[model samples]
Target: MPAQSWKLISHFWGLKAPHFESQFVIVASSFSSFLYLGACYGYFAKRERNKIGKIQS
Candidate 1:
């Protein structure tokens, strides 16, 4: 019985996996880009703050 269920599950995935994979790729790339941009912004902002502090002292 378990084997039969596993076969059914695999068959369903075989039909649908490509569509889900494409969606996952699109989502993952967008997420990574956002993460990279946020890191760059934070780094630049910290550097700018340090420069301001130096000018004040």
Candidate 2:
């Protein structure tokens, strides 16, 4: 194996390894936040249904 090939392999693995953890955490948090907001909006809208404006047919 050439020196360049070894360096390329190491750098590729290094870049990918940390991203797995960070990406999972970021994505999970964002999805949870979105779900929380959606639930809150759904609950509020359900309770305030009469107060909200009606749509025309």
Candidate 3:
């Protein structure tokens, strides 16, 4: 927040700066899940690609 904005808010309610520990955990978890899902998708897609257009004898 800008200095002026914080000063104005301070007149009524005090606003403290955010700590990064919890935010980092949330972000890390989100990225990890996304990467895991993407890897799973790629693995399955590659495995199915070879058989997708082939005729089964």
Candidate 4:
């Protein structure tokens, strides 16, 4: 997953400079993935909390 995203990001920004682009892609891809994963986790976490609260009430 990470590797594929890295490749995708690199291929995107890497058009100008392949060497420098690798590092940028690494950071960008990891950050983007983390952000998305965090968002999904947060959404599900809230849903779970609501469900539990309703059940308990």
Clashes of each: 0, 0, 0, 0
Best by the lDDT measure: 4
| Model 3 vs. true fold: TM | 0.57
- Total residue pair clashes for candidate 2: 0
Backbone-clash count (model 1): 0
TM-score, prediction 2: 0.55
TM-score of each: 0.65, 0.55, 0.57, 0.70
For each candidate in the order shown, give its overall lDDT on alpha carbons.
Answer: 0.70, 0.64, 0.58, 0.80
Regions more than 4 Å wrong, model 4: 1-5, 8-16
Clashing pairs in 4: none
Candidate 2 per-residue lDDT, tens place, 1-57, comes to: 344554565566557768676566555555666788889999998867755544321
Q: What does the lDDT come to for candidate 4?
A: 0.80
What TM-score does model 4 achieve against the real structure?
0.70
Task: State how far residue 47 of model 3 sits from its true place (Å).
Answer: 1.1
State the RMSD for candidate 4: 3.0
Ranking by TM-score: 4, 1, 3, 2
Ranking by lDDT: 4, 1, 2, 3
